[model samples]
Target chain A: MSADPQRGPLPAWSLPAGETDRIRIATQWPEEVTREWAWGGATGAGVRVCVLDSGVEADHPLVGGLAGAKVISLSPEGEVVVADDSEGDVVGHGTACAGIIRGLAPKVELWSVRVLGAGATGSGPVLMEGLRWAVDQGFDVVNMSLSTTKSQFAGVLHELADSAYFRRTLLVASAHNMPVESYPWRFSSVISVGSHEEEDPFTFYYNPEPPVEFFARGVNLDVAWRGGGRIRATGNSFATPHMAGICALVLSTHRELIPFQLKSVLYLTATNVGGDR
Target chain B: MSEPGRLQAAVAAGVVGSDEAYRALLQSIVEVARAIFGARASSIFLLDETTDELVFEAVAGEGADTLIGTRIPSSTGIAGWVLVTRQPLVLEDVTQDPRFARDVAERTGYVPQGLMSVPLLHEERALGVLNVLDRPQQARFTLEEMDLLGMFANQAAIALDLLQRARRARALVDHNASGDTAAVARLAETIETLEDERRAAGVRLVQALDDILRGA
Candidate 1:
């Protein structure tokens, strides 16, 4: 079970035993730029963002709206079934991601496209199919907070981004915060976002150059899970939405803007993270 | 010798007033048109605000005639329709469309089959029309083509507006002889903004346009 928010700042993810005293400073990323960078209602409300991860609970206050999710239920005779709302995040991890995206682009219509199973261990094909479907369905932005090792969908993803560019769409992927060799963050076609832990010691792990393009406040970040228990989250998964939100904001303001415009705006506005990479 | 954006800069810089500025501005426009489109014909028209008519102001085409004084009514022809609606007009068969007035055809003696006409609009106030005639018959105007014309037209409108303002300011500067301080200050402000925007956007435009050209 994750720590409760009522307990105030989970200790496990907190600075371990007073190591917070001499935490080395790095790039001067902004604090709470939801105002300066957001431009508020400039964009975000008009477009649809498909979050392909664990199923999101429809009833969650942060997770309101039908969003038209697809879920296949199975019968005893090895038959497929339909459970649209049931496809939502079964584990609390997916909920954490969904909330981050929701907080950022609140007005955006989100489709909780669930491709991962309970363990967050769905095969590569499942996620790729979701991405193709999202593009086909005319989503303006796609948020992928999941990744893999044996994924054959890398080339397909490049094609997907190019096609989205042709159709004027954006793909926002999380640069895995786990410090693992992963394809999700390393892909060039997608905007790779990493986490920057403000006042936390674990910040450097999130910095090195795998696919990290932009940085967002990520360490000990608060996210609500099932059963009213909340936990301070850690990982690049938590950071990706900030970049996605910024992209959605831009795409929304300048609808006629192509992908190049979208890319330029982000790079221009980004506060360069770390020093070396 | 000055390019379009740079000449606009010189005018803003007080090197010359509106008349000379517009004269050079229009020339550079047609020159760029000749360079990029490889078209033998190009022209610019100024809208008469009071009469709402298109009066041809400049021309650069093969055997391009002086329709300089001809005033085409806003409600009358193809170019007129383009000006009124602020929508681009393309004609693969010029004689086929009822909007094509045949006045330019009769005047220039060029029976052009393909034509592209873009509305010269400044903030929804249709200034006139920027037209290229005798375009190759097989050429179809794509969205990019339409937008490119619109972009060129946008720059032209800015230069033209500045040109007009500069001309009026020249008259004021001569007549008032430095007594009318307030109006002169406002004129200086407008000129500065235009020149500044052009100068700043020029640098960005070169980089971004190169990136776009290289297919990035």
Candidate 2:
């Protein structure tokens, strides 16, 4: 097959770069925002995080307990339907994401918002409804490891993302694995993440680029799967939850911080920014 | 319908009128992708939206002989997942994973240990999927390889989109042949035999006429 002239040699948002310029903090703050300071001793207690993808397998050993679980689907007439998720994790993707979050912030209140069904497939309308529900419920952090390439959903998703930001609900989205454009990851209001090959779960870097803001460990890690199983997988999908889990930890400690402030704290604590690279 | 008007409709739809050429293009895509990835097999499946099924359009390596035109539910396998989510995926140790849809793989007569699948996307619409199964050396696919596979899928998607348009045009032409548009069908067949440059000129002329007619 002929190469597409538009796409670069590497995947979107995976470009290597030198260290970024550090952000100068005001002298008024006595303590530096180290990783310990950002999430030190924080177990994500009382923080509500929503996994907005396929349903998370209930009682999965690695995932522990969930705060709530809901499934969003379409009716025969093409209307959105929201119901309790009795059937857990049609595919293992959501479970894998939830397990990652659970691993980092063990005490975070995890909620499963099942937007994708079997084979990890669902319509764009269903995805929007799921996100809207999560935002309306005021989850502290919503981990969206999936995105819609359909531009028709962009406007609505953008509005929802902005609304979440204003409501103090941080949306952590994964950049599309392919180089193609997608949302709501591309929106400035949301924190977009990509994968890094590093093994450290906490070793994340800040991208100097605009679209994908961060990269976390997503290559070849053992993740929780459906039927209470575990498997090895890799993608930007898994990286998103690591960021979300970190967000939960930060929110758990500093309850008053808004989305933007929380983002600044993350940048300050990033391995490239504060920790030893 | 007037000759220019009929030709304009065909041209407006971007019908190339060559099913053989489209199949050949897809065949080359699978072969090249298989070779590039050094995989045991590679194949492309076209989504039949009407039936909600995926039809194997082309294959290289294993199952190339009997796999063409095979139909499977578009809601079941890895290809189905890619089609619905419009995302690329990579999996290792497919046999051990319960979510791998082993029944579907068994039906196809080839069960892979590892696989990577990407949606063949035309704009936001997913035309189908391109799957590379079981690379020789490694069980896991790197992020870079997934990007390369996506590039191949893009080209395949464009060709598939054109092929679908051609099919629609053929059906339209056939439906109109019994009526006064018989001459238009004849002209379409004639245009198919023309050299590349002349055929392109004919297409451009038809498009211009279509624009004028639409304006009028």
Candidate 3:
């Protein structure tokens, strides 16, 4: 069916009814891979999740006690400086993401990699350094709620994303809220996410489109903010962490699942794909 | 004055032929944005790279009178965040958020309850920020609203870029001329009247000339 014209055309990375197709998976096992088998009852225990954004507030009630936190900054001499993050959540954006992940995967080890500074202002070099550090740490999942529009950093981001994928560190990145070109999220190696209006955190959809792989709840979320407060927020920024939390859940149960395998599990168990079954 | 010397004098003076048209364009953008979002106010802040500050360039509704030409550090508030991240942000309750930079808002004499800010970007470079503050309904900003705001910011960025280029061109022309800046004024007017594609091409040509003149 054609999309309703009144809705002002379908958004990018969304599939119309006519566009969605059913595909049969040829699995070695006779039983179909269901949501129950994938992540049900999985508390994301033993999974290491790195939130690569502004720092997270360790004391935020919704996001209790981070495993560790680090800040990426440039020294006066232009050298990359990685230091302990004593000051937390410069803009509350990272704390919001971390809180969502914590809510979904309570037992997961959450680490904060502060890339953005106060008021969420950050440079591309700091972001790249932060991502590189996260990749080196080999976190089970990395939630990147922010992206750099600078094309100059795309090459390095692409390499880092691929390295994460190969090393079994699933990178969950938020698609730009605007229809603009951005890095890492657009890379095939990452799980690119967009927003849906649904309130259920577990409800997610796998887009037939290539770039944006999934859609999750991101509208009007009451998320934890800095200073142990909560605020209403929206954007693809929040949706990405939901996917990361889910990834943590899957990895928690099936430690041997690689990045590509984890992605396949997500697609097969998406609300749209496996809910009815 | 010799040709080279005249050009040098104009460049040093930072002469921008009349800025009436530029101001009018930005004013129209903020007005339309304010109306579209049903917001209490809308404003545009252009980054002054030399001073590392954000200059209030246009406004509709609140702070339209005394806020224009006011400067704040480019890295101080939500506008700075948008500028650095080149991303759109929507905050529902600015009053409770520390990142709202209340001190800066207090200086402007209007602190919004909620705000949506987007980067005014020309290609990858962020030229400024477009902010829509405190819609009467206090409704949460939707993804669609953010997307529409981004489109508006793109248009604003192009106009701002052209205005900056016009200033440089006016400097070069005003310097060589013996107190007459009409040539550059006519060129700016002509460029503004061109079709979208041609206008962008024309702006590029002017920018190239400006770069070459500066290098000389």
Judged by lDDT, which candidate is best? 3
lDDT of 3 at A242: 95
Name the 10 consecutive residues with the lowest summed lDDT in model 1 chain A.
A199-208
Q: How accurate locally, in lDDT, is each candidate?
A: 0.57, 0.81, 0.82
lDDT per residue as tens, model 1, B71-108: 65553444653453233444444444222325656656
Residue-level lDDT tens digits of model 3 in A1-277? 7667789667647666664542234334327888778877999999999998768999999998999999998876778899999988877778899999999999999999987652223378898999999999999999998777889999999999999999999999988755568888999899999989889999999999878899999988888887787877777888999999999998898888888888888988999897545
List, for all models, the DockQ compared with the true complex.
Answer: 0.00, 0.20, 0.23
Per-residue C-alpha lDDT of model 2 across residues A47-121, encoded as one tens digit per residue: 999999768887999999788899888877877889999878766778889999999999999999987652223
Model 2 C-alpha lDDT per residue in residues B7-59, reported as the tens digit of each score: 66555333365677889999999999999888889999998877778899999
- In model 2 chain B, which range of ten residues has the least summed lDDT? B8-17
In Å, residue A234's CA in model 1 sits off its true spot by 0.7
RMSD, model 1, all Cα superposed?
24.5
Candidate 1: the clashing residue pairs are A55-A87, A55-A88, A55-A89, A56-A88, A56-A89, A73-A81
TM-score for each predicted model, relative to the true structure = 0.43, 0.84, 0.81
TM-score of the B chain in each candidate versus the native B chain: 0.66, 0.80, 0.73
Error of 2 at A136 (Å): 1.3
